[model samples]
Target: MPPRVLHFKSIYLNRSETFIDRLIRHLQRYDPIVATLFPKHYTENLPIYTPSGWWAWRRDCWLKQLNRTPRFLYGLCRRLQPALVHAHFGLDGYRLIGLARKTGLPLVVSFYGHDVSRLPDAAGWQRRYQRLALQGTRFIAATEAMKQQLLRLGFPETRIAVVRFGLDLHQFAFQARHQAGPRLLLVGRLVEKKGHAVALEAVARLHALGIEARLSCLGDGPLRNALKEKAQKLGIADRVLFYGEVTNEQVHDAYYTHDVLLVPSQTATDGDQEGLPNVLIEGLACGIPVIATRHAGIPELVQHESTGLLVPEGDAEALAAAILRLMETPGLVARLSYAGRLAVEQLHSLERMVGDVEAVYDDVLKCIP
Candidate 1:
């Protein structure tokens, strides 16, 4: 039997964090049970451990200041006897470092975007991360760009591993797009880093150019109202349909129905950025040609004019031009779609990511005395 692994995320899951669910689901060599502070979206009904009641939560908070594991968490470790703990986000890594130390288990932390870019600036988190850098056994980066970010945060060079976001190709299966006009799909939370406002402006620009471009936004966020207002201000509110949050199945259906996929991500005002948006991979895998910004790790996958089109981040005019180019050029869409699908299949397959992650687990566990 495979060794049990404790997978920690502050939240059991969220709509945008399907990658975490996929990782825990597809892992072959490790039996993963989730541990979270707040639990939601447990449709899989996996084994979950959480502190129950306000007293338990308050006590855990008091314990953290002393650099001690929450008593409940310590008990859970004693009961489960997981060989290692894998924290999904850097913030959780910092939160659980004490628990890991108490259990004497190797802790592997996956640093997804905002946790590296924005979270450290929150009050005392920088110092907390410095301690995490010292105590965490291994760090997983989704891109070389994120690896540099982790190094800047003081993670050990030898212990950092780059693992690309993986996709189930079968789920996002390829479909040849041959449509008229433009039907654009932008998937991701309506947030600053996602650059939804820029996408709105671009859609408006296309409308002004006598191009009938319609955009459908999947996923929701705190910025939804602001984005809707911006779309109204841009006079493209009708052209932009906000589906808010939808199921993974619905998103896959959108990819198949839509002709173009837009990922206009940029650095948020708070310094939040993307490691690599899995939406781009899903779009590519579904053979929907993508147009993205040259921001963070996006260029690593989009590859400008090869796998997909890339515009300068936050450049509405440039984004409009990219959309117009796609609208005018059918062969470009077919070429990019084929190349993008091939790229993901070669480098970002679910099997490839699972194998790489298990290798990281193996490398970390080898140091056990």
Candidate 2:
């Protein structure tokens, strides 16, 4: 019989999708029964959805709702009876760990930045719950740096594995540059951490320097209208195009049509940050040179001066300078584009990520017997 692995996540937002979806889509390759919480548009051959209310709470009700999740998750696991459970974030990890202890199934959890960093700061019980989650499950780190964070959090080194997120190389392969326009693309939520305001400020700087460039903003959030107002105030509204909440296919097309991908992410005031934005890897895979901030897990993917240019977080002037450098320098774009694509092909392919994940599953399963 094939091994069964249950995957758990809360909400299934378009921007929040990642390699987990890719793994679910290709589960037959690993012969595992993949299960997920939260409903999404169906993909053929993947396991059916198991509903969970882990992420439907507003800020005011989150604490009360979170307290009830462990019971709900335990009930879900009792019904599914899987060999192993993989939770996608630390909070979900806590819930799964509780279920694992109740059901005697092996459990694994992935830490994706904000959950580990910001969620732990909530209150005494939440902090204790975070520790409990880390203690009960095998931890999957997206970067070596994240692994170290887990170590410092008192997790046993033996229980942690560093497995960076991967990309579909076939989907994001390098293609010939087709457009003549200087297009700068930013693909992320229009929120404070994503630094859409920084991108707008940088574009304003570029306009002041008399550089003709168009900026395309993708993805949507609560701050979308505010960001648009900021762009108008900066007098670069005409140059900025807001293509909010685009599909994955549209995102791939944007990668090819644009000359450069800008990811000006910053550590938010509440300590939220980017956990290696998949779009950087996707853009690099599509052979588009990226200009991103030297923040969070980004440096692990973008080799400074090789794959793409890195500027200090929240520095619009430096961002503008980097963007101008990529636009003005002939042959530099081609060199960086080729190097970025090669880096993704060699280091960030889905095969490599899945292989690492399977190894972790094997180790966890061995511990079960």
Candidate 3:
């Protein structure tokens, strides 16, 4: 019986599976069992979709979680006898602090983009995050920007670790792109921080320059209808295709098929931003030129005019220029293509990121009381 980690997520996204699936694949090699809190995902205080049915849950489950949350979670932890508990997001971690105390299991909380960015600005958010930092035994920051944000929130530096979201290198095959047209691809939810609206406006700007470019949006969110309306009004609706959501296979295929990938990320109105958009790395892996903004830790990967072009946030004009530059520049595509793949291997490879995570897990478990 090897160690176990009871991974907790308040609600999981049905579209893009959380980091749990990826982490489980890698961490399973050590014979650790990873379990989830919401046996199936729940949204808006309701079970979104559950094939097995919620009633199938053990009778003890309710008795464990009924009166006291910490006591209930502690009983579950003791019954499962996991060595540790790993929670993603600051809010979730804060919620489980009592469970950690009651169970005497080390808790590792990972702070992703919005968890450390926009979340801390919410009412009473700072105090909650600070409490989580103090109670959590270990912390993982997806990027340097996230690490800095954690420090600013009063988290001890010694407790924080950097482990980026990684991609399977072998999954994304690199094809040296010598020639392609201005066909732009936008990946991620159609949210303000993802800059999908800005990408559409940039496509319109490219149209104004007489460059008949086609833009494909891969992923959907609340802004879907509104963005579609804006594109129609801009008259670029004919050129832009909105793909609501897609499988990983489809997204990987699009990365290779598209001429260039646009990840024009920016700070949203609520102060939400990215740590480092994975699409930039995936585009690089597919050997396509990526045009992203200097938002958060993006510069850590997409260096301006080196691996890919970096544009100013919300500047459709600059983004348009970058799209055209990649199309017209000879040998430029090939150069960035090679450089980008190398960056992923050296920085964001799944194998290495998994090793880093395993190391943290091992270290935490070793010191457990």
lDDT for 52 (candidate 2)? 50
Q: Which candidate has the highest lDDT of all? A: 1
Clashing pairs in 1: none
TM-score list, all predictions: 0.95, 0.90, 0.90
lDDT of each: 0.87, 0.76, 0.78
Model 3 lDDT, residue 236, Cα: 94
Relative to the true structure, candidate 1 reaches a TM of 0.95
Candidate 2 lDDT over residue span 1-369, tens digit each? 667787766654234566777765555434544444444644355655543544532421353256434344455566666678887777767755556766788778888778656676676636665466455658888887677666766677878888888787887768744222478999988778999999999999989989998999989898989998999999999999998888888988988888889999998888787788888999888888888989888888787888888999999999999888877775777778888888888888888888888888888887875
Q: Candidate 3: which pairs clash?
A: 64-72
How many angstroms is residue 163 displaced in model 3 relative to the true structure, after the best TM-score fit? Answer: 0.6
Q: What TM-score number comes out for model 3? A: 0.90
Q: What is the lDDT for 240 in model 1?
A: 92
Total clashing residue pairs per candidate? Answer: 0, 0, 1
lDDT of 3 by residue, 1-369 (tens): 667677665545444554445665666435444333455432333212221335534432453344113334555566667778887677778877878877678899987788888988988888877778778899999888889988999999998899987888787888888865867899999899999888888888888878889999999899999999999999999999999987777888898778988899999999998877767777897798888998999998888878988999999999888888888886888788888889888898888778888889988977865
Model 1 agreement with the true structure over 1-369: per-residue lDDT tens digits: 899898887667887788888888899999988876667885376888878789997787676555455567777888889899898888777778778777789999998789899988888888988999999999999999999998998999999999888888877778876532589889988788999899999999988988899999998999999999999998988999999889988998988888889999999998889989988888889888999999888888889889999999999999999989888888888889899999999989999999999999999888898
